[model samples]
Target: NKRVNHKRVYRLMKQLKLKAIIRRKTKRYKPFTPEVTAQNILNRSFNETKKNKKWLTDVTEFKLKNGNKVYLSAIYDLGSKTILSYELSSSNNNQLVFNTLDKAVKKVKNTKGIIFHSDRGFQYTSRSFKAKLKEHKMIQSMSRVGCCIDNGPMESVWGMMKSEIYKGNKNFSFINYELALIELAKYIHFYNTNRITLKMAKSIA
Candidate 1:
């Protein structure tokens, strides 16, 4: 009855020597500590005069037709509006971020003091990533909690790229993880080479 309170029902059940079975989840909760954190040094400043001075990065996912997903982590040069490097994996982990950063770093020299901005993801906040930033002499910056717009440019890039990829081929599907990775790679190449050139040409026209 609506008037019956939970406590009274529990007391009655206990008096009657009855027990209700409850289901509990099999998984246990795990806690982790972030190895590093930093201030919002970028602070919504999306512009930079030089190519390597400011870099933005984030991870996004692609859903495949078979209900699997692929994680893609990428670094974009804020000044150049260019995709410096990217890595796709089935798992979203620190290694994905590491590989993308490594690829971007391998292509550039003299990376001292460049501001690298990202959301406060565990991968970015890890001790290993902090050490990598130190090794490269780059500055680490993180967005405040629950503030996606703190890294607006990076978020916008992921949105734009995902839209363009699907818009270009409505019928096509990333049927599997490997195929998703391949398609993402192709789209990024086009984004860097063809799409950017066309946008620049349009601006000039």
Candidate 2:
């Protein structure tokens, strides 16, 4: 039998020296409709020939004042791995995505064929958001249905920000939101210029 028969494995005796534990539950969701028409444009990886060639966008939510939620959407340049544009909104609506995309496009003009990759969240899939992408002459790409790892970079970013910035906050207030945004901006600056990315082999945006 490929089993460890150590008594400690089943022992519940030591409450005095117990280790802190975390339990996680899995949730399931219906799959998004596949968008095969869109090119596997990001090539299922993060590489681009030029600085503004490809962009990845994602949305994350945070608990805000009085149980309301604040959503953060951002576009990241695939080449430099820097955040191109980001915005915070009370809801993760299509308007939030459109505004972030508009800001990113304005910030980096000449993105005629850049790819914008994101999960098939409702906001990203909405008519307005797609229209904005089309208006900017941007290509749209979505992570495959039910595959979160396809957007691993953004997931890691969220985890890091939550652990470092929002882990201890018991309640969210307007001032807290302001402070969190400022802190996130600072983190972005440091992450882009100063922080070393092992995957990139050096410090870079």
Candidate 3:
């Protein structure tokens, strides 16, 4: 239909422009003011002292409405600001967290002395989790009980996923969760390759 009527395309574009102009002139939409504040941890210390010296992991739970919940655990490589691995499951347990960690470890060539940082959540403090880190020759690190800055990057990613992609949607099934995961993968690809980071200004040249 668009191909058959070239003038129709121009008319639609004009209508869209008029609508946009009217909306802007009328001030119908208000700017968003963020109520929740995230601390700036990476101020000038964003660079990792060594590769894999600090890795961040975070867990976010989404309710499935029938009272079931899906837990998502992710491991992020702080050095590269990249998501190394993530796992989604109906249960928030050691198994899910371990699977995420193992998948991340598999991607790295050397696992020795990697610092895995997370909140003092039970999943991260469990004996099973500690044992796995020891087995992989990685060190365990934890943030203070109430500090979000300690794991800011991971939390930021989760916030973006929840607000931008899954806003107003709740009680998702496995299939819906899979679709969100695929969308997140696409967003992450755009973030890493197409979106320029302010920190990379000097390096880009």
Measured against the true structure, the TM-scores of the candidates, in listed sequence, are: 0.79, 0.75, 0.65
Q: Which stretches of candidate 1 lie over 4 Å from their true place?
A: 1-32, 168-173, 196-203
Q: For candidate 2, what is the lDDT?
A: 0.74
- Please report the TM-score between candidate 3 and the true structure: 0.65
**lDDT tens digits, residue span 1-205, model 1:** 2699899999999999999978877866265667789999999997575798899999998888877778999999987888999999999999999999999999997899999999888899999999999999999999998799999988988888877778867454588987787788888888887774544988889
How does model 2 score by TM-score? Answer: 0.75
Any residue pairs clashing in model 3, and if so which?
none
Please report how far candidate 1 places residue 34 from its true position, in Å. 2.3
Candidates 1 and 3, the one with greater TM-score: 1
| Candidate 2 weakest ten by summed lDDT | 32-41
lDDT of 2 at 25: 75
Task: Report how far residue 15 has shifted in candidate 1, in Å.
Answer: 57
Error of 2 at 191 (Å): 1.9
**Root mean square deviation (Cα) for candidate 1:** 10.0
The lDDT for every candidate, in the order shown, is 0.88, 0.74, 0.70
Question: What local lDDT does model 2 show for residue 89?
Answer: 79
